[model samples]
Target: MTATVHTLQANRAPSLEPMMALTTSGMNAVNAVILDRMQSKVALIPELAGHLIAGGGKRMRPMLTLASAALFDYPGTRHHKLAAAVEFIHTATLLHDDVVDGSGLRRGRRTANIIWGNPSSVLVGDFLFSRAFELMVEDGSLKVLKILSSASAIIAEGEVDQLTAQRRIDTDEDHYLQIIAAKTAALFAAACRIAPVVAEAGEEAEDALDTYGRNLGIAFQLVDDAIDYSSDSATMGKGVGDDFRDGKMTLPVILAYARGTDGDRDFWRSAISGDRVADEDLARAIDLVRSTGALADTLERARIYARRAVDSLGSFPAGKAKSAMIEAAEFAVARAY
Candidate 1:
């Protein structure tokens, strides 16, 4: 049977706004720390960093860090520093991602690489990476240091794995999951996991939050992959079809290729593997993916993970933080709308 296609809908439920509101005070402190730490006498470091930081994308990762800490009633301000570190790592990855993807747009603005040049962007990314470590070291918690450092290594490994899998239509669903798990979910897991560490909330709470973050991260990336095909460049904050143009074999593409007819498979291989794809080719690829039900199935898979993310919070007592975190999972999938 052909793949099942379902109409997509926007999530009208309040998404991240509530979570942001819940953590507003803590996030303000985190933002202050971020602004203070991002400075430099070299001028370009702040210039480049601020270019992306001020571009208006939601600081979801750092928000997760703060909210997770609040979930456990963390007493110290250490999480503020950790939240800043998380943001730095996330922002650094974005800069490098823009360069790697040869992307020209992010958050509806010119990419840092496009305005500042690739070398500058890459070097500044390295600067941010080093700064993240500096912040970690300043916190002076060995456990915290270990958690974030390991996540950084995993994120780098995930990027390399994705590089290896690129343009290879033979890449499967399992491999796609592995790549995103490391690249995207690792940070989310680390950010949440660190909250419990700082609060001395014990291993049980830490594990639950880690599970929550990992599942939410997977769901988040799934929707992001789907949006790349379905949304406009302006709405998505990045080039539409950038993944398709780069031959990145995300879950939707993998599912479509597997479910497609022989001719459909051939078209996917040619469209993705070629040196250059015309606009018409991307249009046809989107149509093929939709008809094969890849988008709907991929999103359905995301919803499952989102539910798992929400379920992970069941162990926590009923509270605003727990509720917000649950909505955060829903937001991850709902963002596709």
Candidate 2:
């Protein structure tokens, strides 16, 4: 009769510094590709794209690509362009997401959509997507192209599905899982999957990395959802109550709703329906999630997925790359702590 403990001590928490250090040189190359390709005759495209691209994102997707490639000890630079393409795709999605979410802040800075207006943000997002495709094509790998292109389409479909589910209290945990798998995990899978393709590491390695990325992505989003209720805007890099105000059916809200009293449910209904967005409602919402153990449980769920992600790398040789990747997963789940 063993209990699963998911929380990390503050002094003993995992960090991304190892992964960042491992991919430093490769990421420099990818960043160059990103900057050069983002240039366009239309000034507005570069301006809007640069705003979010240069924003303080962790660039985790592209970093995964580079680190996965390093797992194979890949000597060539073929992954640099592909990793840049992954970042372009990710950045484009963020731009469009800010517009769709009507968000005001990201990475503790003003979102491009808020600063440049929605139309400009959306069109610039399209431009970045086009640039991503161009990079993918220039790489001349049909397999890589297929993987990333399909991921892009799946991400779009997921976004639409999430839009349909938005503001709907009936959205369950399984349904929410499906939406995040597509919207978030799809790209993550592709990013790590492309690494094996470029390294000629065969399908088995590709599958393993895909599993790692997909599970890590799910865990990452779970912590983010939990953080929305447990953390502040400065800590989360966006408005703290943005999800509640947007009526996002994240796991915390879902779990809390499922476990809540009738009165609590009524309060959630009102809060999620856009009727109660004041500070007190947010405080009450936080209280409900905490009292119901929804936040703690969400972090626990993230820990499970993070462990799966780490276990998926068992086939790979143990080295710095493997250690860094494992630490990265730990870091993902530990962020909420």
Candidate 3:
């Protein structure tokens, strides 16, 4: 388990750091408001839903929503509602994911499923999903509903594909990209895109934000896959090799398999494909990924996406908000550390 990202420091933000601190300060305020909104409803489903709220997550979805709104000169209360909406949608997914994965630990703590059980988690997830729909209807906009609904559908499709594709071990870059775009990038795209519509940025501006979010989300997933094979369990908050153990093939593993030697390929096929693995298999998998230089190459690909995210900011004017977005993209990649 290594935490070093070769490209993590490539983007140096002179003022972006301070602006990020400000963004985070604002994030805390928004978190409180959103948490309050959640509390009003969690009492009915506390065992499953409350644990998810108290659980640790980066809250990146709402950060994108608020930051995008701020960038478009939105100085109104609507952004708060939208931010909370993004959170509700994201939290709902986490609840469902834990149930689907049968995960016992999240953020180094017991998952809602482990504490309360799967049915509770699933029902509470349904509750949050319905709550998000209710909030979206309050906005009275069809476009918002369309984007979020599409994202939710894509997320579900991604989960289904992952279930079917489990441990195929032949999962290629295309399949890996598709699954992640559907699973992770869909929410990120929605979060960044809805702001332009809420702020009434022109169609062109809205499209740019959508592209930015999609690319940034892809980059984030790439680093996450790298971390699965590289980072220690302590920092990752879940088992280091859970991806393989759970039969989910990601970019790093796919690339490593392609470039590995005969012995490397055999070890992975037998040990990883079979489910139960020794520590030596984990070590060998790490070595195989490193031996093929896949980690460095994949990290470079992630860097390109981060650059694309910054480049998309060309559609926005100069402001602290835009700077924070650039910083957020960089920070996403740096999170590998």
Candidate 4:
């Protein structure tokens, strides 16, 4: 397959049209409702949680929570609880990720760890995680609890693996996929899968949503990795080349190092794996990635996952919910850039 797609967003319109419409929908009372529920329920955490959430999120996970609930024609309002639960889980991970990566910025602002200190950020992340369990238990659903619990464990394992594997050039595409699936895709898969149970659907709807979530999660991470190589601080929110300085081996950089000639191999050894990469060497790394066309190739690979993610949404009937789900998948790849 060719390793370039000029416009992934444009191509995704027909399949993910529903999900894309939501990006234009804007943040509104849905958040107000969620915040009210959160205050009444997890009062103290909401103080910190509100700060983390009250910004420009696409609400993709919460959308999955709602879409799945809507798909089964749910009569009750527990899906609201579940949607908040999704955002809480997502937010907690971001807090923890900043601590782990020592990230100073996220979503175009100072990271929670940077503002609150790693200790507070880590503890707040724990509080939110425990809050999720508290909410899940109130639902009294064993299946929902199980799905989320398993996803959490896998996410931890993926993060541990990533920390251990850093600077290890032997790592390949499969390893990268595995780590992203566990660390990033786990909650997404769980969020979609548990939606049917909240609506009390049978096994089939549950299975389809599970599949959709898994593929979408994988696609999201791939695009995230690609963006680290190509995007700027304004579009990405975080520092450009932040991943490189932190010694992250994202798909584009990984591909470039592997396919490059002997000099390129030496460059990776000296710059990426070395103690401290000078400014000149860092710029060289960017050049090598561009010359190797890995950025375009990685972007193209992300496109494949985007297609798979939206295609998984096809099992459901056509409607606003389905369209939103598809567009959300496309947005994962397109993001701001």
TM-score winner: 2
Whole-model lDDT per candidate: 0.89, 0.92, 0.78, 0.73
> Judged by lDDT relative to the true structure, which candidate is superior, 3 or 4?
3
Clashing pairs in 4: 18-323, 18-324, 19-323, 19-324, 19-327, 20-327, 108-237
lDDT at position 159, candidate 4: 91
lDDT of 4 by residue, 98-208 (tens): 899898777776777777688878887887777777877877778888988888899889999998778777678888888988998888888888878877777877877
| lDDT, model 2, position 233 | 61
Pairs of residues at least 3 apart in sequence or in different chains that clash in candidate 1: none
Q: Pick the candidate with the highest lDDT.
A: 2
TM-scores of the models, in the given order? Answer: 0.95, 0.96, 0.90, 0.86
RMSD of each: 5.2, 3.5, 5.0, 4.8
Clash pairs for candidate 3: none
Q: With candidate 3 superimposed using the best TM-score fit, by how many Å does residue 79's alpha carbon deviate from the native? A: 1.9
Query: In model 3, what is the error at residue 223, expressed in angstroms?
Result: 0.6
Candidate 3 structure quality by residue, lDDT tens digits, 125-162: 88778878887888778999999999999999998987
Q: lDDT tens digits, residues 54-77, model 1? A: 889788999998899888888899
The C-alpha local distance difference test score for the whole of candidate 3 amounts to: 0.78
Badly placed stretches (over 4 Å) of model 4 are 1-47, 274-276
Worst 10 residues of 3 by lDDT: 1-10
